[model samples]
Target: MYDRFLVSKQIDQWLAEDIGGGDLTAQLMIDPRATATFAMNAREPMTLAGVEVAGLVFTRYEPACRIEIHAHDGATVERGALLMTVSGPAQALLTAERTALNVVQRLSGIATETAKYVRAIAGTKARLLDTRKTTPGLRMLEKHAASCGGALNHRLGLDSGVMLKDNHIAVCGSIMEAVKRARLRVPALTKIEVECDRLDQVEEALAAGADVIMLDNMSLETMRQAVALVDGRALLEASGGIRLDTIAAVAATGVDYISTSRPFQSAPAVDIGLDEA
Candidate 1:
């Protein structure tokens, strides 16, 4: 769960979006004091996430509403499995359902996809990692779900680490120049990673004291050669064109980490449904 303030703010925005001026249907047809119980179910198999956020939605509308989650975060559930049961004012439940389910379903989808990648690389030296291609406001929640699914999160933001990409290299003119400039400008404790698209750049990065080198969009043969060239002087990472079917092969190349945006960006939203109990 995120901070209460953050959750509240998000909930407030969602409520405003949903209600607009008011829930005209609820006001027109439902009694103010009417209450009901509902069950949340998975319409398709998925990993669970955002349970607490869902509870927050219920709380925002009906402060006394009770939510009980039968399935835990990070737990895998089959289709039609009961995720949680909520009892609250009918209007509030109706208002909050979509927003709550939206968060859980999307995040669980990311977690589920990430879990597959993590499982694919099991027993390999390579670690599964997520890239910066995360949803704007939901980065924290998405990354949290990725961690739950057993993938290590890369830099949460640019401030967390110094990663010199191709554009940075182009602007600075060379990998070594970028690394040197970054080292001189940034703090001593800042870890530096340089993206190398070619095997020749690997030696330059290592020589320039790059702590980690990303082998972007390289073939397995090239990645293996890069790893061999690195020779443990710096941590090696393979990025780009990674898919579930291809991750194991990439991991087998002896790289320390494999990063991709697929788990967060391309994952289909896990199906979930709300049913009146």
Candidate 2:
């Protein structure tokens, strides 16, 4: 759902932020007609992502730039694999280098990290999920990378789905009232999920007819009970405190989905660099 219009707009913002008042360094050091080719390669294993958008960064400056994407998104690339090649104006290459590398490295890191979580829950009915914990303006791209790494997207934003969190419940005074109001306000196609931190809240949420029930940071015993309590009435999601070391047990507890913030919030950028080709 990330359209070119949006991507281009964001790219404009990035370029404006990074290249304000012209790239005087490039202006001083480079000739306008100087054309060169650059190759982007991985320094470590990664689930390839952002190649296309990274290409866009170059083209955004030099529209006629030649871009060859050797590795597409979701492809697993080994160390030293060539991800892409760009041949264009020397100034364009220099101007686009940092922004392009930052985007691809950050996104590839997320995709590669998410691959671990996906593999951990493989062969199970439980699906891996990503939360709203994403970079403010880059959620679209980041979520796309998560999907590339094999996790399904949850709510894209607050407007995309009806989710009643702890604060919403606290304000509404009870899960029943919060859900009832949301059910009346939203269309039938929209799913209403409630976040319950306690066992008693789980039953109350179930009774309120929420479409999905999230067990937030519950113990293994409590999660099992929550799944049984759900009993096919709603989709069960386990969130909070999920880690690579702990995700398998959480998945085994019969949660329909496992959500974590690590992929978006904590994944280190992959080491990929651009060099003259």
Q: Give me the displacement of residue 80 in model 1, in angstroms.
A: 3.2
Predictions: Cα RMSD each: 1.6, 1.2
Find the 10 residues in a row with the least total lDDT in model 1: 1-10
**lDDT score, candidate 1, position 230:** 86
Q: Rate the local accuracy (lDDT) of all candidates.
A: 0.88, 0.93
Measured with C-alpha atoms, the lDDT of residue 60 in candidate 2 is 89
Error of 1 at 137 (Å): 2.0
User: Among these predicted structures, which one has the highest lDDT?
Assistant: 2
Residue-level lDDT tens digits of model 1 in 37-82: 9999999888777777787888887898899989988888899999
Per-model TM-score on C-alpha atoms: 0.94, 0.97
lDDT of 1 at 30: 86
lDDT tens digits by residue: candidate 2, 204-266: 999999989999989999999998878989999999999999999999999999999899998
